[model samples]
Target: MSQISVVFHSGYGHTKKVAQSIAQGATAQLIEIDNDGEISEQDWETLNQSDAIIFGSPTYMGGPSWQFKKFTDATSKIWYNRGWQDKLFGGFSVSASLNGDKQVTLILLQTLASQHGGLWVSLGQLPSSSTAATRNDYNSLGGSVGVLVQVPSDADADAIPSGDLKTAEAYGKRMLDIVNRFKK
Candidate 1:
């Protein structure tokens, strides 16, 4: 089976919840970015072996968390060696504010992947734009970028919308399907 690696930094539990759903659906390994802004050597090895990599982080102050940015910087060594060239790359982010410039965060991730010569993959699923679709519809416009979960600053993990979680799972599954096809 083709391996997939998800590396992310989550300040609150919202992003972590989305990452877990992605891992579950893709059967991919989850690598947490440590407080020191480093991934375990073993996890780095897994990324080297994996067919795809999915990045996650919460949008903070119009960008991704500092921790995630540090980790990305550290990957420069890998990039020099063309380590991730041609590998599938995807990303997700969460924010407390409705328009927190989450797309900027995704663009940052895409740029990093491009710098490493990786192939970027967007949320392949389209939003249900029909009037018949409700706010809770799966893969809605707001659900783009794997799962852009929204939670009030004071809200707890329990407050996350179920729709966001479901969308994340589906994103993971879709990523795996692409990985499997490319492996063939």
Candidate 2:
């Protein structure tokens, strides 16, 4: 079996819920960046030891939250040494708007993984875009790079759509499968 880790920062609890759903499906460890945009040294060890790492962050101001960015910046040491090279990587982003420029956040994550010479995993799920498709359907937001979750701005974290959570779970499963397939 391969070990996977989900490292993320949740500003308003919404992203944390999404990370939990993905972790459930991936059977992965969760490393949360605290409100101060810092994670423990143990969290860094977990990430370094993980066979696969999935990054999650809520999109704020059309990009990943500053907390997540701080975490990303802190990974420079690992990046410089190519510590994550050849590791499998995945990412997800959450936002309150249906088209909240979530793709930009995902690209930031993908690029970060690429910078460390890690393999990027695409969402790989076809979108639900038909006229009959509803918000409760998987990939209703039609994301291709990675998982995209949208919660209404007025709604609480608990009000996240079921479809988005399920999509996150499925993506977790996909990442696990890929990790196992490429395991040494």
Candidate 3:
């Protein structure tokens, strides 16, 4: 079986919901980056053992939260040893607005993954850009690098749109599929 890990930081709980949906679909484990911007030692081990790592964070000020960035910085130990080299990577992000500069956050993620010498898994699903597309549509955000979502600033985790969660699930499954196929 493919071992996938979603290691994320959720500031207001909204990103946690997105991460949960993705994990459910990918059968991936959740490794949370806590409020202090730290993950446990075991979580670090899990990350090293994972076949794929899906990075997640809530976009803040047009970028990943400083907590997630802190985690990224701590990866220097792994980066020096190329511990994650060739490991598959995917990313997802959520923000309060529709165009919350999600692309920049995703780009930062991809850059981080590349710095670790990891392979990236694209979203691989067609975007929902047609006029007929609804809020319930898949990939409505048209993020090819990974899943991206938007929730109102006032919305709670449970209030996240069903469509965005669905889109996350699809990306998770697709990621797992690719990992399984390439494992042999």
Candidate 4:
């Protein structure tokens, strides 16, 4: 089976939700960027073997967490060798505020994928674009691109609404479809 790996850092579990959703849609492995800035060597091997890589992180201070940044920096060795060249790449990010400059985070991720000579995929679904659309709408554009999730800073993990989770699952399924088609 073709492989896909999602490497991510989650400060408050919101991004983790996104990662889980992506994994559910594909036969992919999930690697968490640890607090100490490490991914297992086994995961590195998995990455090397995979046909696609997806990045996820919480938008912190207008960008990704320092842990995720450090992980990205460590990829310099791979970058030098173009180890990830020709691979499919994609990303998703979550933030507390609705307008938390999440696009900046996504750009940073896309740029890194580009540096590795990878193809980037955006969230394939369209925004709801209607006044009657409610928070429960499938494609509500509350700053989510491809599985964009939003959680109030004060809300506990249990308080995360079901709509966000469903959206994330749909995004993951969509990504799987895209990767499968691209490979063909």
Per-candidate Cα RMSD to the true structure, in Å, reads: 1.5, 0.8, 0.7, 1.6
Candidate 4 Cα lDDT to native: 0.81
lDDT of each: 0.85, 0.94, 0.93, 0.81
Residue ranges of candidate 2 with Cα displaced over 4 Å: none
Q: Can you give the TM-score per candidate against the true fold? A: 0.94, 0.98, 0.98, 0.93
For model 4, residues 1-184, the per-residue Cα lDDT tens digits are: 5688889998877788778877887667899989887899998888898888999999999999999999999999999999999898888888887768788899999999999999887777767668887667765655444556677898766655566667667766766777788878
> Candidate 2, after superposition: displacement of residue 70 in Å?
0.5
Question: Mind giving the per-residue lDDT tens digits that candidate 3 earns over 1-184?
Answer: 8999999999999889899999999999999999889999999999999999999999999899999999999999999999999999999999988989988999999999999999999999898999999878998888898898989998788877788999999888988998998899
Per residue, candidate 1 scores C-alpha lDDT tens digits across 1-184 of 9899889998878788889989998999999997677888899899999999999999999999999999999898999999999999999988888667788899898899999999887787777678887546676546455567777789987776776777788889989999999989
The sequence of per-residue lDDT tens digits that candidate 2 reaches over residues 27-146 is 999999999999999999999999999999999998999999999999999999999999999999999889899999999999999999999999999999999999899999999999
The candidate with the higher lDDT, 1 or 3, is: 3
Against the true structure, candidate 2 reaches a TM-score of 0.98
Summing lDDT over every window of 10 consecutive residues in candidate 2, give the lowest-scoring window.
152-161
For residue 37, model 4's alpha carbon misses the true position, in angstroms, by 1.5
User: What does the lDDT read for residue 15 in candidate 2?
Assistant: 92
**Which of 2 and 4 is the better model by TM-score?**
2
Evaluate model 1: give its TM-score: 0.94
